[model samples]
Target: MANDPTHQFLVNKIVPIEIGGIDFSFTNASLFMVASAAVASGFLYLTTSQRGIIPSRMQSVSEMSYEFIASMLREGAGSSGMKFFPMVFSLFMFILTANLLGMMPYFFTVTSQIIVTFALALFVIGTVVLYGFYKHGFGFLKLFVPHGVPGALLPLVVTIEIISFLSRPISLSVRLFANMLAGHITLKVFAGFVASLGALGALGVGGAILPLIMTVALTGLEFLVAFLQAYVFAVLTCMYLNDAIHPGSH
Candidate 1:
């Protein structure tokens, strides 16, 4: 099972519990998610605990992460969006830590699950909807109505816009889930090849070198993809929030 590319994604109950027909069991995915949250919180707390004139390494990393997310929100949604810094920063750190932790041997990748990713995406879009309506009321609907469209084609454009708006969560979730799933699968397949080839004979051991190299390269690439996907998720969330803040802007 360990050699199976898809086996790594299988969810197994660590502590099964049932309540009135609801199965609320703790699983590997849940464990990793809790771990990710803890790691992010601990890192931030430890790094920022001390005040320094010249920053320590941990302090520098903590400050850089803070500034990076701050700048992203400012650029995407403007200064007003800074109000969402806590949520956006937590989202970024959680996902980033989850991705990095999943790279470790025998660790579960929580974000690789569609349910987890979709939940996060839904939360993002939900925030946009809630804040948009709360702040702008019916004016938020103008977000679906692009400016300067001719009246003749307005209905069709509105329909297209509605579909696009509805699809945001699906696209956002699938992008992260698919990338992690595919990358891990590829890594596992190459790793399996290396193990299988090396177990054969001297000639097979020599052949294993190529797959081993590929696995190494793929691991590094996956690390980059992990961070990039997290950044892309954060940026998209900011853009969506921007639409809520200033509806109908081109």
Candidate 2:
């Protein structure tokens, strides 16, 4: 057990089982991902199963979430983009649940791992690219060409647009993963400081108290970061989708 606290990144095979030489073994990260999916599914299922006229608490929360995302899509992507509501909604719910789940003790924060976040970001960016092509045919290539640029500068401008568009997944995935990883690492380090110093008498105890206070404050901020990161991911997805739908001016 490394005292560094970030040793949690190591994926140990809990079952230690393999099939067809493939590493399909269960690990802490895998378990957390399953838990996240189950929790999200269970929450939405229960919330929508019973629709009361006045609405139950869970139902109200669910409805509010739907409306909230719908409003965001409407504003960011416009009414035409409402077609993507379900995808956006699902993305938000999945990320939000995963984030909050990671905050629980002993639960693995899969999003802290670049592999998980990169997979998600790839899926989203891939979908946008595929849909852009499907919607516009070859004309989607026009996205790389900004309007109002002089013919002489078109190549340079197009190259820049292409690079920017191609970098979407890298930037998007990194933002979330980096935030979760850094925040958790900070919390762990502060906690270690408190533990190590509190062992010393009197003066050390007093010093430990400050780190404890900072730890609590950091925890609250982490919670907010979790939500904000999820929102940022979904919003960026919407913005990219919007660009695909209407790749007009620069």
Best by lDDT: 1
- Give the top-scoring candidate (TM-score): 1
lDDT of 1 by residue, 154-241 (tens): 9999999999999999999999999999999999999999999999999999999999999999999999999999999999999999
lDDT value, residue 12 of candidate 2:
73
Residue 125 of model 2, lDDT score: 86
Off by over 4 Å in 2: none
Q: Candidate 2, residues 56-134: lDDT per residue as tens digits?
A: 9999998898898999998888899999898999888888888889887667888999988899999888888888889
Worst 10 residues of 1 by lDDT: 46-55
RMSD of each: 0.8, 1.5
Which residue pairs come into collision in candidate 2? none
Candidate 1 lDDT for residue 31: 95
Model 1's TM-score against the true structure: 0.98
Whole-model lDDT, candidate 2?
Answer: 0.87
